[model samples]
Target: MLASGLQQPAHGMEAEENPYLEIVKRNAFDLTNTPTNTQQKAPEPLKANDIKLTGIYLRNGVERAAIALIEKDKKNTKPTYLQLAVGEKQGTVEI
Candidate 1:
């Protein structure tokens, strides 16, 4: 003869009861302190026509990346000192 499955010990374990399920609350934290970030614009290469390299000198053994430059907008009269580095929109450019 065929035998049936066991249904005698089905209610053996107990279920857990949460106490704070009725009084749940949340708060919106202030985010004004967080700094806003923006993507940097691609830097355009220094136009050869607009800028003229005045001089390049080595200072001792240290890095001498600082070069004298003058933009055409100023009639090339004022020499604006600049460094030979990548110029980014977010970064300060020496003048």
Candidate 2:
């Protein structure tokens, strides 16, 4: 004798009923709802070309990464270094 398999339909969660669904709605967009006169332009996002990987090291057991930002200041010749691990973020860039 052969048995037939049945499939179940996937269900969607409504935001009004579930708090988890509402969390996505809040963070999904970067909407700026400001008055017409007081609104200012958002800062430009950091580009990949502006970043340089300086070093990577392991401490204890976890690994860490360092990066330098390439700025256009003639007086400040030294690169500004940022140390980050895992999900850490510097400015608009995340590691």
| Candidate 2 lDDT over residue span 1-95, tens digit each | 45456535335744356657666678776556765578778999755446788899987787889898877544357777888888988786588
TM-scores of the models, in the order given: 0.26, 0.42
* lDDT of residue 33 for candidate 2: 73
> Per-residue lDDT for 13 in model 2?
48
* Residue-pair clashes, model 2: 0
Each prediction's Cα lDDT score?
0.48, 0.72
The number of the candidate with the highest lDDT is 2
* TM-score attained by model 1: 0.26
- Cα error of candidate 2 at position 55, Å: 1.6
